[model samples]
Structure formats: structure tokens, C-alpha cells
Target: MEIDFLLVGQGLAGTALSFRLMEKNLKCILIDTPLANNSSRIAAGLYNPVTGKKMVRTWMADYLFPEIEPFYEKLEEFLGKNFLIKKNIYRPFLSVEEQNEWMGHSSDPLLQPYFEKIHTQALYNEVNNPYGGIMLKNSGYLDINTLLDAYASYLIEKEMLMQEEYQEDFLEVTDLGIRYKEIKAKGIIYCNGLGAMNSKYFSNLPFAPVKGEILDIHQDFCPNVIINRGVFRISLPNGLQRVGSTYSWHDLDTGPTERGKRELLEKLEKLIFIENKKIIHHKSGIRPATKDRRPFLGKHPGLESVYIFNGFGAKGVSLVPYFSKIMVEFLLNGIEIQKEVNISRWNQT
Candidate 1:
């Protein structure tokens, strides 16, 4: 069957892009394997507006953070499921210097939107924050697994999803467009995350893959707010909390390792005053990070009919929603993509 676009990989990136494409009256079919190691399924799905050691506003927070909640909420309404949870993130100060630094940042007009309040003392007894913390508004987590499953089901009901692996051997590029097996499309977008590194079309792009792991633990006291410092601890509905993640550039495997668990445990212990926390679950996934730390978007340099919309890294939950809208607009209207994220920047070298 002929379609407007063929999307590879049904991870969060592909799901968002496909949904946006269809919303614009573009016909597209997504091919996915539903692998157990799929990054989106294993992601902690946290979207923080303020991040990093210095606790600065995340890149493009002003533009990106606004689009996140509404997009997910709209999808949740359309899919008949609730996965978006808007919550405040409490980041404890590591030292007096850090607290003083934030004291000045809290007053910045640009940061007023995300800053809720800054505490001079600890907020909760369970959290070991001696130097107090900063409460960030407009931050939360997305239940990615639930959202992906619900959206996949929606696509299946609409006959827009195919559960299969993408075979490049069967693909043929024509002057009109590209054809893969029985499917013909005017264009194809690669959203296969780390798998894109193996694609002959996009492999040359500086795709730096990083391995991340998270743990699900049952503790005596679970705080309502997400406690972040050394490790981010997100509370679930049950008497459980999700804490993670350790970044490893060398070990790229998907399996949960002793070292990863130990590292996370060490960080978790440092963040919260918890003893003997029962480990319920452990998971790992490779982030499709880029060398420049910006998402890779737009058409391939050599193949005009081929394109990409992946490499969201650990911030996929935050980046996907905003970039998908930009990508779809570029796809449909020939609108100029933002130069910072446009693939042409890399191709120019």
C-alpha cells in the first residue's frame, strides 16, 4: 500500500512523530519490533525544567517545557488513558555555596515561570536535605510505557501500526520517493533510537550512545515530591519509588548489571536517608545521544527522500513533543527547521 511516509521504530520518538504526521492528514505506517530493550519502554520518563550540576534551566526550557504537558495531555485524552503526571521536583542543595547560587537565580525573571520556591531548611524528614532545596514548578514525569501502549493500540485500531522489523534490503529509492516491500511512501523517517547508528544512511552522524539504568525500590517512607540531588527519586502510586540513573559510555549492553545497580544504590543512599530499601525491579536502556547534545533532525544530506527524528537522549520525554511539531511542520510545509537542531549543520562539515 502507498502512504505519505514510512516511520521506522515505534519508540516514544516515532510514536510522537507519527501521531503528529497523521494529525496533519499525512498517511504513515510505523514498523516496530517491540523489543524488550526498547529505550522508551525502559525510560524513567522524567521531564525536568532545571537540570545539571549547576542547576540551570534546561536548554530551551522556555520553549520546550510549555509544549510537553499539553501534548501528552492531549494524547492521553485521545487514547482514553491518563499517563501524564504534573508534579513539583525538589532538588536539595549539596552545599551552602549551591544554596546561595540559587538564591540569586530564583529572582531571575526568565526563571520565574519554573521556580516555585526555595527552602532555607529541609522540606521532608525522609529526605536528607540539610542545606534545604529548591522546588521547581512545571516539572513531572510521563508514564512512557502506558502512553506508548495506549498509542500503539490506537494506531493498531486505525491500522497505522505494523509490528515488524525494518529491513533495509527490501527498500528501494526512486525518483518519485522510496519503497519498502509492498509499502510505498514519499519519504521515510528513522526514529529507531540507538538502532539508527547501524543504518547506512545516518551512521556518519555523531551518534554517541550512553547506557542508563534505574531501580524500583520499596521503602518505609515515600515522599510525594520527586527528590533529586545525587540521584532522582520519583515516587510511584504504590509504596514504591523509582530512582536512577547512572551514565556509562563504555558499557553499551541492555542488561542490568551489578555495577549499575550498585552505582545507583550508592547515589540513592547519598540523596535520601533510607536503609535496607528492598529492590523490586531494575532496568537498563541505551540513550541515542548525539555528540553536540542537540537532537538530530531534518533530511539526510545525500538522500532527500530520507530523514531522521531521533537522538533525543535521556530527555526524550521532554524533547519529543516539541521537536515532533517542528519536524512535522517542516515535513508538510517545507518550513525552515531551527538551524541548531537541523541535520544540515552536521552535514556541512
Candidate 2:
């Protein structure tokens, strides 16, 4: 079968790009391996404009934050599913000086858009925020598993997704396009996360894989807004709160460790003062991070039809939507990708 694009992997990166491609009336197919431990499936799916210990604005927050709600809302409407949760993120101040510092930041024009409100006194009685905190707008967590499952069902109904392992040996790269066992496409983009490390096309790129573990705990406290500081605590549908996550670069395996669990618990204690919390579930996945902490986009240097849209890493939830549109533009119109994310930035030597 001949198609415009053959996308390998049905994770967030592939899913977003495929949807964007289809929106432009392009014929595409997604080949995904049925892995139970996929990173997208286990990600916390939080998108915060302000992050880190210093509580600074994330990279490209101006460009990325605006596209997030509209993109997910449109997709939710198309799939007829409700997976986007629009909740403010409340981050407590570590000291009075920090609170005073944020009070000054509230007036900055550049940071004004994301600023919701700043609390001077304790907001909740169940938590440990004695100094007060800052509430941020346009911040929330996406129910990724729900969205992926619904999107997968839609793809299956549309006959656009193929559930199997993609074999590179059968792939043929020609001057015109690419050819797999029975499929012929004008181009094939690899969105297969760390699986790209095994491909000859992208193996040279530095992929720093990091393992993260999250826990679903049955806690009595259910805050309306997401509490993010040392660790993020997101309230789920049931009487459970999803808390995580610990990052470990040395251990890249997708397995939850006792050390990881201990780390999360210690951080969780600092974030909140909750009692009678029980660990209901523990899960882990390895993110396809890069050395410079930017995504790999654009076509391969030597092969015209070969491209990669991987390496968004832990920020995939926030990065994919905006970059997908950019990728589609580059793929259809031969528009140039931003140098920061372009794969061409890395020297093959």
C-alpha cells in the first residue's frame, strides 16, 4: 500500500504527529509495538509553565503553553473523550524571602500570563504550607493513559494503526521514498522513543535515557489544585493521589526499585503532611532524553526521506503538541525546523 508517511511508534510523539498529518489530508500509518511498559503509558503527564527547584519558567514556555489547551481540547472533541484536566498548580514557598521574591515576580509582564494568584497565608489545612504559595494558570496534568487508549481505539476503527514490531531489515530507502515489507511511503519518520537508538539512522545521536518511577497512593487529602514543589502530587478520580517521581540516569531499566520508592516518599513528606497514606501501585518507565535536553526533529542528514521526531523526554506531554504542527509543516511544505530541535544540530562525526 502506498502512503504519504509511515510513522513508527504510536506513543505520544507518533500519535500527535499522525493526527497533525491526517488533519492536512495526508495518508499515514502508525506501526506500534504492543508494549505493556511504554513510557507514555506510565508518565505523570504534568504540563507546568513554571518548574524546577528555582521555580523558573520552563524553556519556550511562551510558545508551548498557548498551544497546549487548544490542541488537547480539539483532539478531545475529535475523539469524543474527556481526558484534559485544567487545574492550577500550587507551589509552596520554602521561605519568607522566596515568597517576597515571587511577589515581585507577579508584576513582571513576561510572567504575568501564567500567574494565577499568590497566596500569602496557608491555603489548605491538611498540608504543610505555612508560608503560602504561588498558583499558576494554564497548568495541569493530562490523563495520558485515557487519551492514548481512546485514540488507539479511534485509530483501530479507522484502520490507521498496525500493532507489531517494525523490522529495519525489511525497510528500503530509495531516492524517491521508503519501502517496507508490503508498504510504500514517501517518507518514514521514527517516533519510536529509545527504540531509535537501535536504528542505524539515529544511533549516532546522543540519547541519555533516564528511569522514573511513580506511585498511586490512597491518601485522605485531595487538593483541588495540583501541588508541585519537591515532588508533584496530583489528585486522581477515586480517593487516590498520584505522587511521583524519582529520576535515575544510571539505571535505565523500566522497573520500580526500593530506592526509587524511598526517594519519592521522602520528597512527598516534604511536599505535604499527610497521614494514613497507602501505596496502591508502583510503576516505572525510561524516558528517551537527550544530552542537550531538546527534541530531535527534521530529516536525516544523508537520507532525504528519513526523519526522526523523538527525544522530547520527560516534557513530551508539553512539547509534542506544538512540535507536531512544526513537524507536519516541515514534512509537507519543506519548512525549516527550529535549529534548537533540529536533528542536524548534531555532527555525525
By TM-score, who's the top model here? Answer: 2
Predicted structure with the largest lDDT when compared to the true one: 2
Q: Write the per-residue lDDT of candidate 2 for residues 1-349, one digit (tens) a residue.
A: 9999999998899989999999999999989877632889889999999999999999999999999999999999999999899999999888899999999998999899997999989998776788899999999989888888888898889888888888999999999999988899999999999999999999999999989999999888888899988889999987799998888899876579999999999988877887678999999999989999999998989998999999989999999999999999899888999999998889663
Q: What global local distance difference test value does model 2 have?
A: 0.91
Q: List lDDT for all candidates, in order.
A: 0.88, 0.91
In TM-score terms, candidate 2 sits at 0.98
Superposed on all Cα atoms, the candidates' RMSDs to the truth, in angstroms, are 1.3, 1.0
Clashing pairs in 2: none
Residue lDDT tens for model 1, 1-349: 9999999999999989998988888899998886532788888999999999888889999889989999998898889999998889999988889889889887799999997999989888878888899999999899998988888888889888888878888889777899998899999999988888888888888988889999999888776688888789998977789999988889987699999999999888877776878999998988889999899999977677999998999999999999999999899888989988998888633
Clashing pairs in 1: none
Clashes of each: 0, 0
